[model samples]
Target: MSHVSGDLVRRYANGDKGIPADQVWALEAHMETCASCRQLLASHADGIAPLLDTVWAGLTPAEVPAKRRRLSTWITPAGFPWIGMTILIAAIAMLLDALTVLDTSFVLLVAPVAPMLGVALAWNKNADPMYELVAGSPRAGLELVLRRTVGVLVVMIPALFLAGLPGRVSPALWLLPSLAFTVGALVLGLLIGVTRASVVLAGVWLLVVAGPSLAEQNVPAVLHPASLPYWALIIVGCVAVLGLRADSFSRLLR
Candidate 1:
């Protein structure tokens, strides 16, 4: 195969002249096998050379986004299934309470802790396939965490309301505790893994609060009206810790 003329390559590179279609095709094909001619073309490109390089540079992997097609800047597709499962569990708990199969006290026992599981799932590496992408985003960490947490509560609190209807469990009984537990889990999550932190808190609630409440058929003291002030204090304190440690969420464990 013959090499492209220096004149043709320069013309093509610089938009100085338009070559005939047939010759342009042959010249391009020839350049594929002719590194010397390719170099010669680039040398003749002059002022247009840098523009060509810039265009090519933009096509490289380095120029591409680290992550792609994330569902939202904050939440990911991985969160949906977990949130749905949490709601389903809440609905089942409601049904059980309605049937009186589990005592109303037992229903109340799990209500505050149920949403924490969803929050854990929202950001946990094990639960989210895109955890790295979600957590490493520029808007990751506290802002992203808070958005997903809000999503969990938006879906969860309403479900709890419907479920608690049959049991006559007051919203006041569970709401502040739910928020407090979620914030506390997040605060602890900054040190330990979020999944582990949430699991630990939930397990503690089950063993210390739920089990005893169920066995004795009474509301746990923590869920009582007089305890509301302490829950409020927990909420304020955890929020401050979360804000202080916001950057930690951006660099989550792989």
Candidate 2:
């Protein structure tokens, strides 16, 4: 790397992202192959992490809320996967109708499609046209999580209500799966930076939860029953995961 490039990496490592981004991008490109430069970037991250924590902690509620909203600026990018999610949701909705699953119960899955896709599209930086904006801010992680989660919920709930009009599963009941999947996968995404672990965990969680249900095995009634405490625990666990690690958790939006 050139001398200028070395200096920029130092600034970035020191968490001085104020450097014109082009300068930093050059360093990141070079650092991709250069271990010494990567080491520097890691050092910068160490300093930046603590500083970000302080910025996050001292954030006023008002500031936090606005910052979260700012992350909503991007629409999910258009792509095959999103089209697939939409098609899957639509197919499920149509199947519910044909099967005459509770008029309303079947359709609930329909609403969340757009929002889910939208957020997914936004977080997907692969074809992202907004890297500059996303790259500029550390808070992008938190905002990214909040935007997609909130956006999908806004669409998913309404569509579900519309599609499942008959006395199908209670919206309250179905809402659990949607919310749980979002937070759970989102959490895993943040930690692993990939959907594989989250997807695996989800499959396992489903087996544990729905498998017992589908098998309809005889169980001690008390052990089998899903009590209020169970729901409370579920909620508490999800909330803790979201709240305690908003920074790290938000990174999962990727």
Candidate No. with top TM-score: 1
Per-candidate TM-score against the hidden true structure: 0.72, 0.49
Q: Give the per-residue lDDT digits (tens) of candidate 2, residues 1-254.
A: 45335566667776685888787777667877888767766765765687788898788455334344242343344434554565567557656666753323334433322333434444444545665466456757656657655755665566556555543534554555455555655556555542443445546654665445335532212222264355456656876876777676333344
Stretches of candidate 2 off by over 4 Å are 1-75, 78-91, 100-139, 205-229, 249-254
* lDDT at position 18, candidate 2: 84
Clashes of each: 0, 16
Which whole-number lDDT from 0 to 100 does residue 68 have in model 2? 40
lDDT of 1 at 78: 73
The true-versus-predicted C-alpha distance at residue 188 of model 2, in Å, is 1.9
Candidate 2 global TM-score: 0.49
